[model samples]
Target: MSFRAGFEETWRAVLTSRTLVSTMLLAVVLYAFYYPAPYAHETAQRVPVLVVDQEDSGLTREVLRDLAATRGVRIVDTVADMPSATARMRAGEADGIILLSRGVTRSLLTGAPGGGVGVWVKAAYLLRASAIGEGVSAALAGAAEHRLGSAARAFGLRTPVRVIQEPLFNTSAGYKDYVFPAVASVILQQTLLFGVATFFAGRREQGAPPMRRAAFFGAWAAMTLLGVFAGFFYFGFIFWLQDVPRGGNVPALLLTVPLFAAAVAALGLFLGGLFDRSERAMAVLVPTSVPLFFLTGSAWPLDQMPAWLAALAHLVPSTLAVHIFVPLNQMGARLSDVAGMTMLLAGEVLLYGALAGWLLTRRSDTNPR
Candidate 1:
């Protein structure tokens, strides 16, 4: 078959197959709304916290007032001792407990060594824990500065150094904004791989002949085109709808998408050649999704992973694509900034394309037409 004919045939097969349509096209649209639904609130707000005021001093009272005023935490209850605060937390009445130790006011005023503030948070929900920590820190800082200022005035002392924090890229520092952009690349790869693998594996199961070189190339092109469209749908429209952080270099994104798509499509075709049944493709590949997502290092640092495992992860298209797309789409990175990864992505296209072509063109007794 000619390249154009193979391309048209693949497109027809995709459109006509309900399974392929659902997996490739509709799933992308469905997940765009579904995955980000829980994150609609973005940042955690007014996390409930119980305060243990052992100091019971004027300084500790001022800090409690400031903590109650902050948007990130709410002082749901105050207890005279740590045991009561711990009980409230264990009972789920509050997300965390802040303990103001005895002599805290004296420590702040005299620069003494004994008193301190202790924060105990439920690690069950990391975002809530983080919110509570931030809220408490802000409140304590305000209280310390106020108390110290009065002391400084009496002694005619100089102002203490203050630390200013500004969040980069994700200004709000919300969970969704941090996670969704990285996951978008994984979604694009998995959905496209499912559709492409199912299509070829089904053909193999039907005892179809090995594709001619032109036809294999054409089929690969068709799948790549679908992947490109899916990438744009997530990066362009879905991001805007969900209000995830974006506005990266448009030209760099344009350059990166096709390379990433072609690599994934080629890799899918190569894997598809191994599966004689369509169901086998889904059975094997579905289990791999979570592992592949973690390999992207959005949730965990790659440096922390075993060196060999981290190196092996680069063989997957989504790993490199995540590194490229997240920065290009959200961090405003220039092409030069991601040039090394871009070149590696292009290399995967060549490596996988060659493997796929060789695999799909090899005739076998089971696939004989």
Candidate 2:
């Protein structure tokens, strides 16, 4: 077969194959809508907290008002004691409990250790817990600063240094914004791999077709094009729709995207060639998603992982691709900044493309059954 003929055949197969059309293309669209739904709000808001004010002092009241004012938390109920607040949290009416002891204002007034504020947050959901805790702490800090206003200034009791915070990226500090870019990279690799695997595994099970140079390279070209299409659809349109932070380094992305897609497609073809049946590819590859995700060093830092494992992870394209894509796509890194990973991705394209082609062209008896 000529390259043109092979390309046409592969294109037709992609159009006809449910695995490529529905599972890969349509699924990417569905995932775009569904995956980011939970993150639509960006951050949790107005988390309910039960306030217990035994002191009934002006300071405690001020703290309550501040808590209510913050968008991150709301003063859902004012209770008289810890037990009642605890019960409210347990009943799911409140997400946290804040307690002001009886002598809190008296102690502050007398310059003696007298009373304190206690905060109990539901730690099961870390993000919610953090937002609630930070909100309450800010309210308390502001109230304390206000109460000590003139007296502390008169006594020259102010700290010499003031810390001002300005977050450079992920400015809203939303969990979705922080996590989705990394997850999207993994999704691209896995969906492309699975779709291609299913297609080739089906071919292998029916009986190994005569390996022609054109057909083999044409399949590779077709899968790479499909993979690139999937990458752009997710990285371009989906990320825009979700309002995820993205950089416009088109040149850097253009270089990285094709390399990553080609490498993933090559790897899928190699793996698909190893499988004797269609179901076997999914059974083997689906379980690898989680392990590969962690290996990308998004969930856990690569330096912190075992040295051997970290070294091994570099062999997987995503381990390197995430580093390249995340910086180029989300962090707005320049092409020069992503040069190393760009080289790595290019290397994967060459290495895997050669391996896949070699495996496909070899005698069927040599391939695993």
Clashes of 2: 0
Alpha carbon lDDT at 261, candidate 1: 95
**RMSD of each candidate?**
2.1, 3.3
After superposition, the stretches of candidate 1 with alpha carbons farther than 4 Å from their true spots are 154-161, 364-369
User: How do all models score by TM-score?
Assistant: 0.94, 0.88
Task: Look at candidate 2 and tell me the lDDT of residue 253.
Answer: 79
Q: In model 1, what lDDT does residue 191 have? A: 93
Q: Which one is best on lDDT?
A: 1
lDDT of 1 by residue, 76-172 (tens): 8888788888887899899899999998888878879899999999998899998888888898899888878777878899767799988789977
Angstrom error of the Cα, residue 76, model 2: value is: 3.0
What tens digits encode model 2's per-residue C-alpha lDDT throughout 1-369? Answer: 666776777789879887678767887788778877897777788888888899887888888888889988988888978888888799999888888898887776665786987889888877778878878778877776777765678888883243467656786788888888888888888888988888788888999664566678888888888889988888898888888888867887787888899999999988888898878898899899899999999989999999999989988888988898888888889988978877878888889888887877766334432
In candidate 2, stretches whose alpha carbon ends up further than 4 angstroms from where it belongs are 102-116, 152-163, 364-369
- Least lDDT summed over 10 consecutive residues: which range in candidate 1? 360-369
